[model samples]
Target: MIDASLPEKLKEKISSFSDYKIFTHKNPDGDALGSVLALKRILEFENKSSEIFVFNSIGAHFYFLPGIEEIRIQKEFKDGANSPALFVLVDCASWGRTGFPFFDFAKKEVIAIDHHPKRTDKEPLALEIIDLSASSAAEIIFALARELNWKIDPEISFCLLAGILSDTGAFKHSNTTPKALKAVSALMKNGVNIKKIADNLFRKNEFPGQLKLLGEVLARASLEPRIRMAFSFAADKDMKRHGAEEEDLSGLANLLSGIPESRFSMLLIETGAGKIKASLRSETHKGVDVSKIARLFGGGGHKLAAGFEIEGKIEERFEMIKEKIAKESASWRI
Candidate 1:
């Protein structure tokens, strides 16, 4: 159901604008792309003009999603060219996340739609539609569509289903709720091929190097028996040795979290000379809040899954993370 306070306001604002520029966070995942594309299609159906602006190229895995071809890179989107009436920020927690110089277009009204909790570091401009309980940003978009009485075609259904499937770990993650499944059911009613979508997302033809990287990561995994936490690292040299890109690091934490003795797991990858990216995951039943650890390092996400970026020597960063996790786990009864 739509929030009573915001839907009317959103309806009024959407009806008033005929042109819009949409943005999602840099290095977007399926939920971010799906939500943005679904909204763009909905706007176009209403005879309004809408365009997507993203900082990075969409991953090849997402090419199957409808409207993937329509996304524009940051270099191609000019602030004043279109004079867009509304800047719709979808699935992004903060304006800086768009990785575009949004300040240059500060005159345009903004609409922030996201499923993550608001960040304490930066305040977003314009009306906010944040629902942390929602499984994915696409779930919120689905509710918004119903409230607006917009028509849902097979393409849109496929897009929404992709978002839900990806963000919910194919409905196996903790965020999967009855409402989320109901949304999936509704989307499938449009004749979306659930199996096809699942296969395309989870059974993609992975590079042999990626498989080798995963094996190396597992082989090097370290465990803290007291905390029941497992961790691994992939330095730049490791990636080079394995012929793997940073994208290959995806799902590493989740794979480690499956260890029967592990209550939580972490994966740290050296992104650049002095930069590291950390991905954290915890068993939903373990009562571990990895997002708290993420926020400690200037990042945010849900309780079960979260990530952050930091700068330091790889060993130093790993030690620092271990200390923080140890401190956090010290208080847990488990």
Candidate 2:
């Protein structure tokens, strides 16, 4: 069962508010957007005024989601327009993750919902619903919907299903628990098109350039047999050479994690000069907590998958991470 007190408190807060603004992290994935959109639809169904505030463009793969067009970027959101009484943050672990203009907005009543491990560095908010055991923030949303006794229409089902599917790697990831599977079954009963959502999320229609980039990154992958870990890096130059964007690097870590001998995999991308984004993933049975490695660099996520950003030369950062990982893996009996 889920936490009763948190959902009940959120229900009371949601009931008291007529206008609300939803916020998610920058470069939002399906879990982030899906959770936000699903919540927005629910509030609107109750005759509450709600809008989602996100920065950056969503991935093209998510275009099939209902109400996808209504999402507004941070720049487009006008300040003080509706005087929203409540700010609902979904799939975001910390206030800083909300990005840009929304982050600048002074503290109002906040309801933060997420499945990621909490960062002790960040202070607690007015209402926080965090269940790291849940597969995704969408899973928590599904639970909340049940607690509120809201109707689960097809659109809502699709949104929540997408979130859960995406975050759990289509239910193949380690976080996919029995409860998550039960939730998916319920969503399917609500008329969610499972095959269509799965195809859209997992089967990407790759452009030639993206294919080239993927090949290049994979061609240079390094395997550390001692730790049963593999890693690869892509520089901005490499992206330009292949005519690929940062989004094209989406599944690189997952791809690498599938290596037969790899207990974990890491993918580092040069987002900008002297800035690197690192993604990490580990096999569920490896007994390695990649999230701990990520936390050492000020990032937080699930044990199997996590990521962090560093400001340094790609080579320098990679070496630093390698050393850190090596030290951490030294204690492993594998």
The per-model lDDT (C-alpha) reads 0.83, 0.83
Residue 208 in candidate 1, Cα distance off native in Å: 2.1
Worst 10 residues of 2 by lDDT: 99-108
TM-score per candidate = 0.92, 0.91
Best prediction by lDDT? 1
RMSD of each candidate relative to the true structure:
2.3, 2.5
TM-score result, candidate 2: 0.91
Could you give candidate 2's per-residue lDDT for residues 56-80 as a string of tens digits?
A: 6678888888998999865444556
lDDT by residue (291-311, candidate 1, tens digit) is 887887888888889888888
Colliding residue pairs in candidate 2: none
**C-alpha lDDT of residue 216 in model 2:** 89
